[model samples]
Target: MQIEVLVDVKTTLGEGPLWDAQQERLYWIDSFDGRVFRATADGREIRCWDVPQKIGSMAIRKDGRGAVVSLARGFHFLDFQTGDVALIADPEPDKPNNRLNDGKVDRRGRFFAGSMDTMEEGPNGALYRLDPDLTVTRIDDGIIVSNGPCWSPDGRTFYFNDTWSGEIWAYDYDQDRGAVSNRRSFAKVDRSRGGAADGSTVDAEGFLWNALVYDGRLVRYAPDGRVDRIIEMPVKKVTSVMFGGPDLDILYVTSMAKPPLPRFPGDGVLRGSLFAIHGLGIKGVPEPRFGG
Candidate 1:
């Protein structure tokens, strides 16, 4: 059976849904809107924060602030309470056609993020690691569209996706030294089946939940890379997913209300909606903050 929707939030270009355990709130980004939103599980009133530039990805800091990516200004510190933005660090000063994209904090508190070509043809995008000392280092290169970065439950495996290539790669991650090695294929999605895997999340059971962009579905895969379950969505372009709600039984998916597909009918109605799928008893680990 397909996952059912509990509610819908009309969001344009929704991405990066993160659950805050302490606050029990859900946070996400609307890249096209240049905004960050925090809302309850039932899809009630949403608190929106405007960013100076397009925010690529964001995670909650130890201090309860937002560690956000400012497209041209590099990493920025966002005071979620006061809406104050400060500069953190920037990597590609020369490549103005690139900006940070999907990213998450490791269990050890190190933030790992990647950039994408803003020009759509530029290949300067790369993945990076941000240490607690506020230092940024490029970890992987030659990426066109970067996503995922969900770690296995035991913390020994890291999953990353290049959506354009329709391939998800897993690497052996070292917690003590903060290194990733033994990169290999974890999953190869067929673009013809739907779209490539966009943002992804790992459940407590170690199952990888992948948002099938442009396919209007989220697929759960076992460790061996077999499709375990498929959850349908009303909207396509599912940018990201996260486990939220009181028990984490609720799966929150943020999607892009892409412009109407002229040739493809029934495309305009589902664009830019936040969907909730219930009944999955999966609790996502809260994102670790910097220096926590």
Candidate 2:
């Protein structure tokens, strides 16, 4: 399907985009710029918050609060209503180069997030699944840049991406036990595109829609690992995609402009911007917030 830009906010390293069904709003994060953005379906009523460290990812709560992964510390509970913040836990206290990245709640409403290396261009990342009891488990390791942790519609299959290897891996997920096993390569993309699979979300039909960061497009893959469809975007770096809006027919995309060169006029112009597109009317499960 063809992609049409909805709104462009010009974000720097824009990554995670989550749809909060209760509030009918979209929450996203600008990784490098340390900012979080919340907007409505019409692209109106936009609000942005400045975070102290790099804001890696965000998820809404059952009570309309926000939880963020601070790059330097651990998970934090954010008060969208009162602007108060509190730390939850730090799984990797010794690894300062690694920070939390993409994450979302599972079918059981448990938060599953991963960490990435801040210093290197290659692998040094790990995948983590946080239980409701606040126990964090290292599910997958040896990842150079961990990406999506999206689950299939049935909650039996899970998909994750290792960006540096250009492969998206699938797993047999046990929702009741909160476990993932049988790790296998789900899809491998061409390296010439300059970006691997970044953040992604699954639709009701079980198709995994992945945003190809720096490749200027979104790809839909079948459950068996076949490319089903491709949705091209205007921006070169398509950081993330999520199904949002009242009917979930709208696909909210977050993009990042190319970084500026030294002594150039493009310093902050293209780095951070929000974009949206319509036409695909797929309803995604509302992000399972903490204590859901």
Candidate 3:
């Protein structure tokens, strides 16, 4: 496979690469920078908007006008035309030390996101779901750092991970009711090979692709949780991954330029750049938009 830098914006902490198939465009976030970016499939004609606070993730609206974003404190509706933000709800108003993190939309068009402790020291965060009617519900709790939210091909299984815990969990998802239960450990990161799990997406064949932040490894796991493949990235601070391009054959990855703590040292020269991987012979399912 071939990999090339699509954009060299040098984001502080870039995450959430969302491809809009209907418009043939791409949307991503500079999490810590509070910036939202949109670009053509070729990474040209870029447009950017600044949010007032840090953003964790974003999903396009079904109407295609704007997006529902997980800001630092809560969920908000972002208008692309005017760059306006309207707060929806803050599920954890009591936990002032926590902030919303990685998230994705389910096949049924509900947005699912999890919060994380800003200090990264305690499990004060919880996973939440925002339904189409604009109501929010708490799904799970006791997470230190949340990331990599996605679903299986059949929509029966849900996958998410708490970065500090080093394990990815699988849950039996109720598509009709937008509920998750029967949580079990699906896979654990080999800290010897890579860092923690950051972001993930499922392929057409049901294999899961996850970016291991701090170690620069993109791992693909079979449905049974076996290692299918691993591609070493040029930058060590790889933050997230998504399948984009017109045919959904390209893998778009996001990274960070700013070093986290002394423990995760050594940043590469090409850090914070967006990358596109081609010739993988793989295609991803269409990302569902927020029905609300």
Candidate 4:
């Protein structure tokens, strides 16, 4: 299938593709620029919001107000109308070098996010979860760059990717207790493709769609981590993806633009933009909202 450009609002680092089923709109973040964008299914009517800080990700709220967003240091409640952020929790108050990265809410309606070092310096990052009661807890440690926190369709398996580790892991998930156990390597991407494992989503068919940032490809992996298909992209840096539209059939993607001294000359010109794919014959599940 061919991918079409949705919007050309180039971003420094685009990530976090979210689908708000209740509002029937798509939300994603320009992570480095502190911007968030909203668009309709048909790729029309785009709205941009300037967040207070480097916005890593956001989760829909159950109360219908807006999203629970992750910032450089912690979590906040972002007011939908005013673009105001009320502080919630600063997970790593002492780790100034660490910033919030990719995240998503689980089937149990709890927000799970991770933090990573800014310079990709070392394994200083860690994964965490925000309970419905507004409490914060740590999950794992020693992660340089955290990315890809997606789940399986039946809610039995939890998948997480550590870009620095170049591995996607699957764990037995406990929905009621909000826990993950028995970590196993699900997939290992060949970073030689000029990219690292980034944001991803699961399709209704029990397959994983993962973006290879700077590799210009989005790969679909079967439930067993077998490469099912690979879709080439126009730009080098494909950051993240999500399924949207009324039928949850549209696949929305985000990319990153290259800087002045373009590393791969001619590449990344169309980077940092949103792209969409349709008629893929696969559907997506609704993203759970933050129950808190």
Candidate 5:
């Protein structure tokens, strides 16, 4: 397999890579910068939308109007044409120290996102589900830094992780009802191995691929929680991953540039760039759009 830098944008806290198969475009977010980016599969024709607040993640709407996004304050609807942002709901209005983080849509078209404590001090955050009717529901709680939200190929299992905890959890998902239960530890990263689970995506074969930030490793996990493969990345702080390309064979990764965090230090020239992995011989399921 070969890996190439797709975009050298060097984003700060780069995360949430989303591929729109219908439009043949890729979307991503630079969390702290409050920026949303769109580019072609070849990393061409790049466009950016600057929001007023920090954006955690975004999913396209099924009606093809715009996107439903998680801003620092709460969930919002973003209009691509007029660049307008309207508040949908603030699930945690009492927690001023938390912000929404990584999220993904289920096959049934509900958006599931989790919040994180901005100070990284305690588990003052929770996971939420935004339904098609624009209503928000809390799914799980006691999270420190939320990341890596995805689902299995059959839609029966949900995968997510709390970054600082180094544990990735799996849940029994009721796809039709958008409810999750039977949470269990699917995998745990040994931080001593130089990485922590940051973001993840499931392949067509039901394997989980996770980006290990601060360690520069992409790990693929089997359905039984076995480590299937590990690919060393060129840059540390690999924040997130997604599958794109006409055939969904390319693995697109996002990384971070800033190096001030005490736990995750040291920076390199390519620290904040986007990368694409070619010839993986695997395909990804199309990301579901938000039903709302």
Candidate 6:
């Protein structure tokens, strides 16, 4: 695979890369810096938007105008032009230590976000689903740090990750009813490899590609739970991966410049930069938009 640098913004915790196909642009967030980035495919002309709090994850709106962002305490719809925000919901008013983490919109267009305690003290996190009717529901509990929420190509399988336990779980999904059940272990990370699970996405073939954060690599798992392929990255702290471009054949990856210690101990030239890998012979499906 040919890997290229997409952008060299050098974000502290670069993550949540989303492609706007209609506009032919990419959007991602820096969770530690409370900044959002917009860039062209070639990395020319990048822009930044500052949100009030750290934006861990976001989903594009149905109208293609902006994104519904998951902030520290709650959810809010953000304006793309003015960076204006409107309150959506605050489900965890009592858990001051918890913050919203990775999220994605389901096939039914419902937005789901998992909350986790910032300090990783306990299993105080929970998975929440936001409906188009502006209602919120707690779907799963006992999470330390929630990640990975991607669906199978057929929309029947729902995959999610619990970072602290290093396990990825799969569920039987009902797209029409917006329900998930029959949870089972799909894949588990080998923490001995010096990495934990992070953000993930599904390809056209229904394979799930997960970022092994501190391992500086992304692993693709087949639907049957086999390790299909592993793509090693130059930088340590790989945060997220998604497929974009007009044909959805381009793989965009985000990383963090985690300091104090490097994972592999090298020069780290590409640390904290956006990366693109092409000609992998795989493509991606369109990301579901937030219905609300």
Scored by lDDT, the top model is 3
Residue 261 of model 1 has an lDDT of 33
RMSD of model 3 against the true structure: 1.0
* Residue lDDT tens for model 1, 1-292: 2365433556667888888877788888887678888887776667888888877788888877665554544888888778889888888888777778888888888888888876545566888888878888888989877788889988899999877777788999999978899989888886785577889988888999999887777889899888898876776677789888878777888887653233322345656777777656567665666552
Model 5: lDDT equals 0.91
TM-score of every candidate relative to the true structure? 0.92, 0.91, 0.98, 0.96, 0.98, 0.95
Clashes of 4: 1
A best-first ranking of the candidates according to their lDDT comes to: 3, 5, 4, 6, 1, 2
Off by over 4 Å in 4: 259-266
Model 6's alpha-carbon lDDT is: 0.86
Candidate 1 positional error at 13, Å: 0.8
Pairs clashing within candidate 3: none
Q: In model 1, what lDDT does residue 9 have?
A: 53
Of 4 and 5, which scores higher on TM-score?
5
For model 5, give the 10-residue run with minimal summed lDDT. 259-268
lDDT of each: 0.78, 0.76, 0.92, 0.87, 0.91, 0.86
**Candidate 5, residue 168: CA error in Å?**
0.8
For residues 1-292, write the lDDT of model 2, one tens digit per residue.
Answer: 4355455667767878888888888888888787788888877788887777777787776666656454546777777666677777887898877888888888787888888876536566788877667777888887767788889988899888877677889999998988889998999875575767888998878888898876777888998889998886766677788888888777778877554222212323434566666666566665666653
The C-alpha stretches of model 3 lying farther than 4 A from their native spots are none
Error of 3 at 247 (Å): 0.4
Better of 1 and 6 by lDDT: 6
Compare candidates 2 and 3 on lDDT and give the better one.
Answer: 3
**Model 6: CA > 4 A from native:** 259-267
lDDT pick, better of 2 and 6: 6
